[model samples]
Target: MRDAEYCFWHSPAHKEEAAEARRLGGQRRRRERVVNAVYELEGMTNVGSVQRLIEIAVQDTLGLENSVARNRVLGTLAQAALRVFEATEFESRLTALESVHERRGKGKR
Candidate 1:
């Protein structure tokens, strides 16, 4: 799943904000690799690949040791992680997503 974003900018201020998202989201293709590596090494069964990676990342990377708190943090990170791998395989799935968004945006001209 490629998490991609397309923003509509009607003003210069919005354009600047969009630029920031674009810049930060650049090279987000690494999410799949990092998450995949974590799951493979940890052998986490219950968590999906994305969630497993997020759990390890919160613990190992963020140094959250408390299990309960770690889970909460991991949940937040899981949401963020969705953005981390944007458009890695974007071109393939993008057309469908774009089509849906396009149809919605252009309804009943």
Candidate 2:
């Protein structure tokens, strides 16, 4: 008798179809990984200081080395970091200038 497992639907002749199914499954798995990475990055915003958040975002973006979306995401994140750094520097300089103004006013009194 023919092997019980070798029914016509499950026969070796259909191996290509089975391989295609496996390939699609792998693509779904990769998509899920990217989604999870996005959620992880979003969660960082709620839980960390700005510096910590930036660090985690950069590190996570770096970890997506082979991802199709990696370069786009990294470029956006880098632009955001530049803005944050510039704002911080501006605030610091403003505070220092205000401190100098206060001292000069005190000297005149």
- Give the top-scoring candidate (TM-score): 2
CA displacement after TM-score superposition, residue 93 of candidate 2 (Å): 0.3
Spell out the clash pairs found in candidate 2.
Answer: none
Q: How many backbone clashes does candidate 2 have?
A: 0
User: Could you tell me how far off, in angstroms, the CA of residue 103 lies in candidate 2 after the best superposition?
Assistant: 0.5
**Cα lDDT, all candidates:** 0.63, 0.75
Highest lDDT among the candidates is held by which one? 2
Q: What is the lDDT of residue 109 in candidate 1?
A: 69
In model 1, pairs of residues that clash are: none
Quick one: how many clashes does candidate 1 have?
Answer: 0
| Cα-based lDDT at residue 73, candidate 2 | 82
Instruction: List clash counts for every candidate, in order.
Output: 0, 0
